[model samples]
Target: MADKLDHLLSDYFRGKLDVAIQLRQMELTYRHGTPDENIGGGRKQNDYNNVVESRMIHEQNDPELKRLRYQKSVIKMMFDCLIKSHQDVLIDKYGNKKGWVTIGMDNHIDERTARE
Candidate 1:
């Protein structure tokens, strides 16, 4: 029962995190722009033109980046409440998307031990 519950919780958190990530990706995509393309070919392109385009890119992406950062911060804070090993396990399993066998190998433990 405990194992099943653990798996269920893992799936729940993974889904939540995935949704947050996908939303961020969509936000970024909607902000889609290519700096060079925007400033098309011109004979007298100067340093200021490049600088302006770079700034524009930063300004455009800032809001989406901030939203994503906040969501990730919230996730990290929640994970921080767990014991160290458990935190590592959850991060490796969900964030890194590793299988139990690979996680165990990376952490130098057996699969069953890693799963437990």
Candidate 2:
């Protein structure tokens, strides 16, 4: 019964988080824009130009580059909390832990942004 309740709670939280994430994605997509390829009667041409120009400036600015650096960002802490914290709950629900999968995923993250 405890396991059943835990499963239900996990599902409930996962569903809520997924919905929140989708909503946030919609909001960001609205800003980062569409590949519609038409200026149309939508945002003015200058507004579109500004967004592109802003990105160009960001690409050039040293302070912006430093701020953008994820080098200081630790993905391990995130995985430790999200995956490690939930490992037992997941094993209880699914009967196995993906230890190698987690290790492989960490390897991918390191490979993705490694400056070395």
Candidate 3:
């Protein structure tokens, strides 16, 4: 039988990379800023650009980065609680997105064993 925590942790691990990527993209948007150079109006154009840029930098509505960080910390705590073998397998499978075959080869074990 599969433990519920194991399943949740596995899912969390798989999503970790994607969450990190999203956070990075958000940060990049903040750093690079929203370009609105071709605004035909004068003060309105500048105001609009400033508003957009401020919103992006503030990220008031989106707590995704913070949530991802919390999730990552939870995943890390779960990993620390797991046994060495389980930790190795999960880290290889999820962290590096490695296949069972690669994990097996790396660990000097059969692919089937790695899969288990």
Candidate 4:
């Protein structure tokens, strides 16, 4: 169970940067506009139909974004609940990709303890 938690935390540390980047790109798309889908001669729909379709599409939730945000929040909540020393050890081992020896030395604990 400990190993599984460690692996999950390590993956979370690695993926957080990627998640931030993707979310930023999404934000930029919303800020600037999404690319024009109706380039050249496309279907000639009426203005009312176009407006209704756009509203429906925009109003729908994105499942991927929702999952990402939920995962981030849950991970953050778990991280926040740990004691400071354990948090430091986790950050060094997973976030910094440091070895157990180095983490033990930094925290002044036994190498085996740090690994555990």
Candidate 5:
């Protein structure tokens, strides 16, 4: 479980920039409308066809973006509950991608304690 959480945190850290870029692109696409080549040709007609509904559907259907958002939120919630020292340790280890020895030294704790 710890290893899984660590992996998730690592992915969250690495995907932050990607998430931001994707969100910006989504916003721009919504604002300016999708390009002609990107639009699909379908003959199905639905009464629920509206810009707001389309945007909501587009966002909701994007699984990768949704997963990234969830991972980001989970990390944020975990961070919010931790003490300052623990938060710093997490940031040093995951956010800064520092080694255990370096993190321990920076925090004035031994390597084992830092790992813990």
Candidate 6:
């Protein structure tokens, strides 16, 4: 049962990856930021003080430093796939069969622009 569950979960996630699932993950990270990797939310206000103080006092880099960088390209590519998929949405309630941004937009998708 466990193996079967894992397989289903993996398959579901892979299917979502065809479009903007990456974008969704990025947004989730920005809002709640998983404990496993704070990259989900970027840096918080408290982190700034601590990291900056440590850097100045220690005069050395910090682990938080490496995690500070945003995976911009990866995020954008994910958004692009999502945008492309949206183009095929035949209905509102029923969109992508099994799938799922910037300053943090949805690939900066603009329906008014008439492009998905």
Give the per-residue lDDT digits (tens) of candidate 3, residues 37-60: 766765553345475677566664
Q: Against the hidden reference, what TM-scores do the models get?
A: 0.37, 0.23, 0.44, 0.59, 0.65, 0.18
Give the residue spans of candidate 1 off by over 4 A.
Answer: 1-78
Can you rank all candidates by TM-score, best first?
5, 4, 3, 1, 2, 6
Residue 67 in model 1: lDDT: 60
Candidate order by lDDT, decreasing, is 5, 4, 3, 1, 2, 6
**Maximum-TM-score candidate:** 5
The lDDT, on a scale of 0 to 1, for candidate 6 is: 0.38
Q: Candidate 2: minimum summed lDDT over ten consecutive residues — where? A: 67-76
Q: Give the clash count for each candidate.
A: 0, 0, 0, 0, 0, 7
**Model 2 lDDT tens row, 1-116:** 97864454444334543454345444443555356676576865554557556655544554523432332233224435765424444443333323434534544533222212
Worst 10 residues of 1 by lDDT: 4-13
The worst-scoring run of ten residues by lDDT in candidate 3 lies at 42-51
C-alpha RMSD (angstroms) for model 6: 16.4
Query: What C-alpha lDDT does candidate 4 achieve relative to the native structure?
Result: 0.74
Local accuracy of candidate 1 as per-residue lDDT tens digits, 1-116: 97864564465456764575566656544564555554556654454647457655764667755665666677667777888887777778865679999999988889998888
Clashing pairs in 6: 19-82, 20-82, 29-40, 29-41, 30-40, 101-105, 102-105
Query: Clashes in model 1: which pairs?
Result: none
- Candidate 2 is scored at a TM of 0.23
Model 6, 1-116: lDDT tens digits are 96754443343334533334344434433453335556666756554536445434432233332222233344345546665445333212123222221211333434543223
Residue 34 error, candidate 4, Å: 12
Residue 104 alpha-carbon offset, candidate 1, angstroms: 0.5
Comparing 3 and 5 by lDDT, which wins? 5
TM-score of 3: 0.44
What value of lDDT does candidate 3 attain over all alpha carbons? 0.70
Among all candidates shown, the one with the greatest lDDT: 5
